[model samples]
Target chain A: MKLMDKLQILADSAKYDVSCSSSGSSRSNRPGGVGNASLPGICHSWADDGRCISLLKVLFTNVCIYDCKYCVNRSSNDVRRASFTPDELCELTIQFYRRNYIEGLFLSSAVIRSPDYTMELMIKALRKLRHEYRFNGYIHIKSIPGADMRLVHEAGSLADRMSINIELPSVSGLKLLAPQKDPASILEPMGYVRERIMESRELVLYKKPQPFVPAGQSTQLIVGATRDSDLKILTLTEHLYRRYQLKRVYYSAYVPVNDDRNLPSVNTSPPLLREHRIYQADWLLRFYGFKAGELLDEGHPNLDTHLDPKCDWALRHLDQFPVEINKAPLEMLLRVPGIGYRMAAKIIRARRVGPLGFEDLKRMRVVLKRARYFITCNGRYYGGIDLDSGLLYQLLSDKTDSKVMAGQISMFG
Target chain B: MVYVTDGSFEGILTAVFEAFRNREDPEEITLGGDFQLSMTAGIREISTDTEKSDRVWRGVESKISKESLENLYMAYLSEHPRVGLYIYRYIKLGLNIGRKVEGYLQHPDVHAIYDLSRRVGSEAHLFLGILRFKKLRNGVFYACYEPDNNITQLITDHFASRLSDQAWIIHDRKRDILALFNGEEVIFTSGFPGIDHEDCEGEYEELWKRYFSAIAIESRKNPRLQRSFMPRRYWRHLPEKQL
Candidate 1:
């Protein structure tokens, strides 16, 4: 196939893997090199939904050996197959970089002939870009399941970031849908890479050789594909963070592309709202010092559709109401529904200057519409009867029109 | 009555400190030409004072965090004429509660400032990577930029260090600011020369245009998404946009 033809097919197939962030890495243009990745912010081409489209996100080949039901490029699907040579990809990336079209490459492939074969080809493509072409921009490569751990680490060293998609949340779901793939194959390489990175860091602590995987590792979980609850998904994400030291666990709301007996055949669009809520919960866990168990358990497996997880949790824990405005700690203030990290920091800073009154809270730009019910000013609560469940619900419903609700549910927004 | 200064960041910051001490009408603290033309009005030509300027600088610094101070600095570089007035208003809004300026992402006035700042900041950053230099006959490296934001001033330090040994002139064609480096010292002023834009086009430019065309995956072309990232307003200077 022509190079452009291959690009179209491969990029189309690769669009489903949506963890396309190019931020957080720091690489500058070499003496004669063409491109550089910024440290504080990445030069990303954002889609309408506000997701960054930085890399020339493409696959080496779309022809797969395994039939993962939720995947668009599964073996049985009637999609076109195209492959590119390493030189072709490198030339494309360099040319694109010169034109200010892209920052780098996000290259992945299906198991073309074997897991080792596919991985080796992927590594060759990246090595060609790095060593031969001297392209020093950001590169994110996918670790093939069941690929050799050594090969995974080799790819990890060359690329800025690496990701291994869990594909499905549960073992039984993987068994039912993609029997050829196993959780151990995915996590084993992840575990190996994790250890190698740790060892490299330990070596570098003594000012030795700078080590592997500088940008860390991330994983993706397919939401709404199986009957896995949000609670189960988050619990697994918590374990991945705590146990594997995973940098990010992206939740892609499943969009069924192939008709398969093992997968749930939903007639509606993917639960993008639920996936958004999961990201909010993920942020709370990562940055806001909340735990997975605090949000959900067996009883409330799914997040509430009407309210955000933070708001829902706040509503349920009504006994903690009217947290003193000036006296409450930063963490407690962050737990409130309307308050974000910025607002919490602002509240902390403002209170250090003087005792805060109700009017002062509004001047500080707190969302008093929601914070009023949850906060007390100088031990005086003006939120009497308004904090009642039925009345609060009515007020919230009245205030949150459909458009504002849509904006709240959107992760990109 | 208070006097409004010309719409420069230094001018606005000077007016802010002037309003801070003046016990006259506070609402008169606005941009240029807001005075009522009465004898009671005290119009002051606020020359750029680096000392009182640094004091207003300290106020912005002590009031908000470091990141916010940088953002306000960039926002003050926006192309909007009334941006000085808006920034003055924003700082007054911040004075009531020191951290109120920190939430620049949401508050309408602060968001307006932040949007301009982010545009200028990102453009300055993009120029660091994208701006190309050409060698003139006089051994001077000349580069022209038509930035949507007034980011030409931010490129001086970048070019100064990167091309330290070379004599160069970076002209912001739109804003009429020239950053001239004489291989020893750098100078900033407002003098932009006209150039025959068509005469400068050549093979490397053609090659760049070719690469841009070939890179787009035709089957997945979304012009809306493309426009969102590199807005059409910036395309006037880009070689690919000329194609």
Candidate 2:
């Protein structure tokens, strides 16, 4: 098949795995080399899906032996199958890199013949790019579930980031949908990679440094595919972060591509809002000091569709309202719904010079509409509605109007 | 005193130098051509002097931070007509209060200049991702972008370090300036028409477009969100946007 033909089929197959971040590693462009990785990743383009196109994400091939029901490349599916030769892959990547079309490559694949076989081919392409062509751009490769740990190690040394998709949120979901796959196969490689990454850092001074995925590791979860509650998902996310030290846990709104009885129907639209809310909660977990138990409990198993997780949490705890803006600490300032970590830090910095008034907050570009309710600027409560009034909830709720709500749905959904 | 400058970054710094030396407070510092006729009677024209500018630049570095110096230069690069006056006032304030000038957000003058500097820096940062380079027929990569602000110089180091092995040219078509880097050095040329040598396109463009469309999930198409990130104003030169 033609190179362009293979690119289309492979990229189409890989579109559903939506972790395209190219950040965290600063790979130097070697002398007489072609490219380098910037510390903060740059998004080359925004796809029509509204996702950032940071990498040239593609599968090495779409031909699979195991039939995972949620995947587009399931073995029973009669989709057009194609694969790129290692040489063709290298040629495509170099041309694209020099043209500034992508940061680097995100190489994934279906189980092509065997797990180790697929990994070896991926390592060959990566070696050619890094060694032969002297390409030093950011690469995020997928570790095949049952690939040899040695092969995974070889590939890890050459790439900047590596990820394994824990597609289902629960073991029950995996058993129901993909009985061929076991959770141990996925987590074992992840555990091994985590160990190696930690070991690389520990032996940094004593031994010749081995750069094993300098950008760290990430994982993805398929939201809304199974009957996983938000509490379950967020709990699992917190566990993954604490246990595996995962850099990111991307939640892909499960796009129903297959007609499996166990999965959602093909006509069902992906639960993008849920995915977005999970991301917000994930950020809170990572940046803001919010625990999963604080965000959700057994009583409230799902995030409110009308209110963001932060606002929902704030509404539930009204005694914390009217936080004194100037006197409040960074932790308290971040608890306000509209005030992000950036705004919180800015407040901390600016207030060190002079006390910030409501006017000053507005001038600093604070999202006062939402923040005013939760904060008192210089001891003046600007939020007209009483904190306990039901009207406060009405104002804070996102469903202000049908038109604007529709726009938000389209934007996030 | 109303001062007129040559409208370059150095010209603004020289105005700061002359202001300190002559001990005159500048009310409005306009560019040579931008000065209003009503203010022509007592206007003092400041020439670009590298020695004088460098002295003020070093003073800023010693008294404040290197970050503050970059901020001042970035604000000047905004090419605002009142930017010179803003810098003069900012320097007057910075000299006395030292590094605290950056934190005085309550002061309108300080806030206005810092805001402009921030916008310029952000534009420069955004162009790091948005700028596209096409391979020229002569084997050098060529790109032209119409950024909202002058940022070609700001983005030069990023592309230089990344594409060091290849020669490339970045053209700020909006400002009629070309930043040509021949793998070793960077040269800035201005007042030139925005036509370039032939681009060896077609194959790369087609392949990129195909990949772009194929990668977008049909169920998740949101053009408005796409526009919010990659604005329509920058779509004129992007290959995938053309398709």
TM-score attained by model 1 = 0.78
TM-scores, one per candidate: 0.78, 0.95
Instruction: Please write out the lDDT profile of model 1 over residues B1-243, one tens digit for every residue.
Output: 455666566777777776676633344444565545656665655555667767887877887656667877888777565576567677777877676556533355676776688778878876664565544545565777788777877877755644555677887888788888986677889866656555443544554444345434333334654565567776665555675
lDDT of residue B242 for candidate 2: 92
Docking class of 1: incorrect
Q: Which numbered prediction scores highest in TM-score against the true structure?
A: 2
Model 1 CA lDDT for position B195? 60
A74-180 per-residue lDDT for model 2 (tens digits): 99998999999988888888899998999999999999999999999999999998999899999999999999999999999999999999989999999998899
Q: After superposition, how far is residue B128 of candidate 2 from its true place, in Å?
A: 1.5
CAPRI quality level assigned to candidate 2 from its DockQ score: medium
